[model samples]
Target chain A: MSGSLLITFDKVWKSYGQGEATVHALAGVDLAIRSGEFVAIMGPSGSGKSTAMNIIGCLDTPTAGTYSFMGIDAGRLDRNRRAMLRNLYVGFVFQGYNLLPRTTAVENVELPLIYRGAAARERHDLAMKALAEVGLVGREHHTPAELSGGQQQRVAIARAIVTRPTLLVADEPTGNLDTARTHEIMELLTRLNTELGLTIAMVTHEADVAAYAERTIRFLDGHVASDAVNLEVAQP
Target chain B: MIWETVRLSLLSVRRNVLRSFLTLLGIVIGVAAVIAMLTIGSGTTEKVKADISKLGSNLLVVRPGRPAGPGGPGGLDQATNPLGSKELAALVAHLSGARAISPASQKQVRVIFGTESLTSGVTGTDSAYLDARDWKLVSGRPFSDSEIRSGTGVCLIGETVRQQFFGAGDPEGEIIRVNRTSCKIVGLLEPKGYTGFGQDQDNVVLMPLAAYQRRIAGNRDIDSIYVAADDRTPTTELLPRVEDILRDARRIPPDREDDFSIRDMTQIADAMASATTTMTGMLGAVAGVSLLVGGIGIMNIMLVSVTERTREIGIRLAIGAHEKHILIQFLVEATVLSLLGGIIGILIGLALAGLASLTLAIPFAPSLAVILLAVGFSALIGMVFGFFPALRGARLDPIDALRHE
Candidate 1:
């Protein structure tokens, strides 16, 4: 079900400091991901995977190359403009779940919609739908501290999808979960990809977590080491 | 959005109750002091005006001696000619705008009736004295012109004298001894209360001018003259005429300052009121210094709050909050805090002023304008002091703030 390209990175470079102390986080990276595709990014430490993911989510801009999102040169935009782009199209699921502590799961899910300036009632209904989609119907009132780790991750995913974004950028979404919880989370994400056609780009060091994606791209020393497709999972 | 921001700010303020109260203390004390000082000052002004008006309205007091100066004794020079019958006679004869002109000589004298005795102010004045001083008698009649001329031993007893010698009983037709001479109380003076300077105006006796001069003061020297202006004649217009007439009667040359000073009660009232106003303003300015210090305290606490909530700010930023949104939230929080302090301070200040008014016997004059100004000022202080810290929080990089532990 792959469609037209939605994200592209051409010779993207991100560096820190200046001159002799410069450290390149992403160097000469070239990548493309199309709509309805679930792509997994894998790398060792300091292999530029996180930096590439950050650029794709518009949380950061490329230091020296072009980053195009849905035909717009997003890397050239200012901080506020990129923030608007992220709010409109990109939803993020971090490894830490990143649900605000002491906040209820529904409230946490309603956060992105709040930034979108949706009316309170509409935001609540949409957040409730998103939570139900993540299988967190009766747990809407439970705070992040009260919820289990997997449930908290589900709440974070609900927050990411509350605005019905086109792209979901998950950075090691199941890194903090155990094996069974991880399987459940990966399965829910797979159902979302197939049913809603939500484009997903995930970063992970775990091999099994990367196995859920339709395509896999590996980074080593700030460059893509390989790009391949999984031939299995056609039945599942 | 603003309502939402205000609600959020109020929630945050409520979360740290003790810290918010501590931050509010400076503003509270400042506003309290300002309110109390202004309220008491206005009350004092009102009391002073009332005291002067009690002396007389549209009236002037002509006293012997040049006006008091820094280099000279304050209106106590005994060498200058005393205002006497001659000046009184000239004013009565030639002054057209004067409604009444009367001369008075006064002394502290011991008066005795039955077994009771009290030391009271005794004054000798003509029948026109009551008209000139705007005084009224509650019972009996003023002295006849024959009594004023013939040095008759008749008098009017004031409220304090009647209370001491008669005890709620009418003092009219009662005989009281003044000094060594006996006099009949022909009238009861109305209760005039006390002057602003705490002098009991009711503890006095009034008698015929000839009787007081002959029996009590033992001299023909008149102490002062009261001149009341008629309606339609402004005191300003009558003042120059009185000066000219007095100058002519005293035979003073055009170049030399007159030996007698004439005081307009209205002018004195204005001066005293304005003096109190100036004092109030100065005290308010001093209290305003504390408000500034309070503002600094707010800034300090807001800075700490920003640091403590850096991660929260980071999350808000990552979720697409604008810099202005973060700034407005903290600003609203500070404003709410200080406004609460200001309101509390106003109530406390009013209480203090009420207590002062009770003890000092002045009017309770709480000005709504002053209260409103204080409220507006505290809000401004919050906005002014809360700005830098709010900006500091707003300008933080989302990544760096998120990374902050």
Candidate 2:
């Protein structure tokens, strides 16, 4: 049915605690995404959409069931293994655009390369290439404080792509941007997913942001309410 | 990698230069105090050792005592009071290791030379006294053995006595009088400032033993005897044997306490060395406590730094910049502060030590071990006080940290 699904979540359950204090952040969520697909997870404030994004990003583990990313069995991954998995295949972009403010745009992008112990020249070349891809080529020398909120988010995007990770995990990537900059950010993400054939999964509450993805998955309480292919996707 | 991390941390420090300098103040002062205290303490110990060694490490002092009376006729016995001419002759005859011995008497009296008059101490002994106490004549010569036996009214006056009696003039070979007796000064002794008891040693004159016994002490008995051991003998090995000889000379019965005392200069040296070591240890401890305070100051500022840069930690974490990287950055920053502080403190301490030596008229000597210990200790402080803050920064959650205001 699915051609070697890049990501597969099988009846996964994630809860906050034991007994009476257990917060059912996710309950029996099953999902699958093929290679090169762009999907958006949409939900209300109390829904488990963010939890699903965290699990997909390898920032957390599920209480029950199995998660396989790119045919790798990730359910029993240790801390080192999870870190290695995140480094090798997944890149995260937070809602707040968590770029180290003290670092310039290129240096911010160079951070993941540093973790990979890349040589200085290679790291610089890759970071600049990623920044240029996001259309921040000449602005690589500017720190986050010197950039606009949209520019900062773009730099975060540049950093996430620096290592050429297989999966791009964004949690409200354009939350702090205006409508125009939000469109610019969504356009950048769509181009990366389609043109570069990079698999992308994003979590958002904004209907307009969700419209950019080819598929939309909706959550209610702690379970998926509906999953459907977008009929009128606005992505590149 | 270390240098890169150092450079980054240094840049962070530069971002808030005033805060960084203020945070490092404690380290600087602590290091300086440690160096200063150690240098001065060592200088003091050095001065004491030099002075004590001047007493001639091989010298032994002896004094006569009354012999106990048998059922007490005149309340004295030959066994209690001895060590007279016979004991002296026996020691000089039998002990091959004995270099020389001086019989001595002391008197406090007034000295007059022409129109000059001064009250000073006078000692009566032979040539051996000069060698035993490491005394040398600055001018003229010491009294001959012929002069000592004939009770020749010749004297050797110390620097203070000469200055008092003759002012800037050469007092040696000049005639001076003690009480009512005329004596010519045959030698001028070099200055020996004071003893541990603050007694002025340079204000005395030396005369013949027989002259002092007949003219001043008015008795036949000598006050004390000073013995010098040969170069082939060591004070440590010779002391007990000499003690046994003195006990035998005094004729103390077996299993009995000897009446007279024998003082070896070696004991004085050991006691003084012990005291100085104790003082150095105490001062080092106090300086160590100040260094601890300095370390705490570093920790306090690092804690504030972590709190201030919460969002930075969050960002680094999100980028997969491992917890170890954050830990190393903060640790390196603190270590740099402490190391620089240590350097400055060492210089200041040595300067203080030099100043003390200059003012106190003692020798200034630097100690390398102390300096190295200070540097190492400061480095350790940086690590100990820096760990918790670095760990706190490393453990921050990417989500909460990114959200921190």
Model 2, runs deviating above 4 Å: A1-4, A101-106, A135-143, A179-184, A228-236, B1-46, B64-95, B106-122, B144-221, B236-257, B278-314, B321-405
lDDT of 2 at A34: 88
Error of 2 at B161 (Å): 6.3
Best by lDDT: 1
Q: Determine the iRMS, in angstroms, of model 1.
A: 1.6
lDDT of 2 by residue, B1-405 (tens): 677777777777777778887877787778777777777777777767777777776777776543244623332246546346556665665555766777777878998877888888888888888887788988899889899888899999888887787778987668898988989988888888876456778999899888887788777766667777888987666666766776676676888765665677777777887898799889878888888999999999999989999988766666666678778888988887677677777887788878877877666867899889989988888888999999999888765776798
TM-score of each prediction:
0.88, 0.78
Q: What is the TM-score (0 to 1) of candidate 2?
A: 0.78
Interface RMSD of each: 1.6, 2.1
Worst 10 residues of 1 chain B by lDDT: B70-79
What are the clashing pairs of model 1?
Answer: none
